[model samples]
Target: MFKWEQLHQYGILIIVLEENNEAKWIIALGDDFYYDQNTMEPPVGDILLYEAALEDNEVIPLQYQKE
Candidate 1:
């Protein structure tokens, strides 16, 4: 939850890191469909850490797709 950059052609990229300062994840939006493929599976405590973009103060709106 620090750096924020705006892409010219694509969209925005939000970087989220793990507490151990090792594992990392990127939240990207625009021109892409984000969904939790394991929605029917068990919780691994890694929901937002997956594909779906995590919202912030800069997040505008999210178009939810019917699964």
Candidate 2:
């Protein structure tokens, strides 16, 4: 779970990525921030896809991979 600081005043986040040999979960995060943009004009509320994982599952932190 994640939210933009500007769009979401709470600035709260909880991210846990995971993979399963038996049955894996494909977590993804989509954004239109366009890294090419200058730091002064960083994008906000661009992530369009936020999927959840199984409860208590082993996980990976696809920090940059999903973002």
Candidate 3:
């Protein structure tokens, strides 16, 4: 599971790389609702990549959606 609280505590930025090579920012927050985060809006897909902000952090694959 992608834990926003855990990510936030480490000051990480979730970067989503699209097929076109563009990167989108993922905002993690404690709220259940997607609208609660000011930086990121709801994504329109089920699969994405989640990573930590550190240079040595590994990227984790995630399937997420707004409930």
Candidate 4:
């Protein structure tokens, strides 16, 4: 079972690396900002793939894996 959650306000890219007992979820946050008076530029962060863990069929926070 997988529960979807809103991670980013703009957009996101998801990719399932593996599907088994130990699965890997890769996510990439989009670099787009909404036009508003308070908001000027996009989010300050590198556009890269991040790994997310699963616990009891629930997705946890994003974790950066070095490999």
Candidate topping lDDT: 4
Q: After best superposition, candidate 2 residue 34: deviation in angstroms?
A: 1.8
**13-65 in candidate 2: lDDT tens per residue?**
33233333222233333343345465654444433323343565543434333
Return whichever of 3 and 4 wins on lDDT. 4
**Which candidate order results from sorting by TM-score in descending order?**
4, 1, 2, 3
Give the distance in Å from residue 24's predicted Cα in candidate 4 to where it truly belongs: 0.9
Cα lDDT listed for each candidate: 0.38, 0.35, 0.39, 0.43
* Model 4 weakest 10-residue run by lDDT: 2-11
- For each candidate, what TM-score against the reference? 0.23, 0.23, 0.21, 0.27
Candidate 1 per-residue lDDT, tens place, 10-67, comes to 2334444443344344444444434467686432322222422355434334434446
Off by over 4 Å in 3: 1-8, 14-40, 44-59
**Residue 8 CA displacement from its true place in model 4, Å:** 19
Where does candidate 3 clash, by residue pair? none
Which tens-of-lDDT digit does each residue in 25-53 have in candidate 4?
A: 55554454223457754344334444555
Model 2: which ten-residue window has the lowest total lDDT? Answer: 3-12
Off by over 4 Å in 2: 1-16, 19-31, 52-67
Q: Quote the lDDT for 33 in model 4.
A: 22
lDDT at 17, model 3 = 31
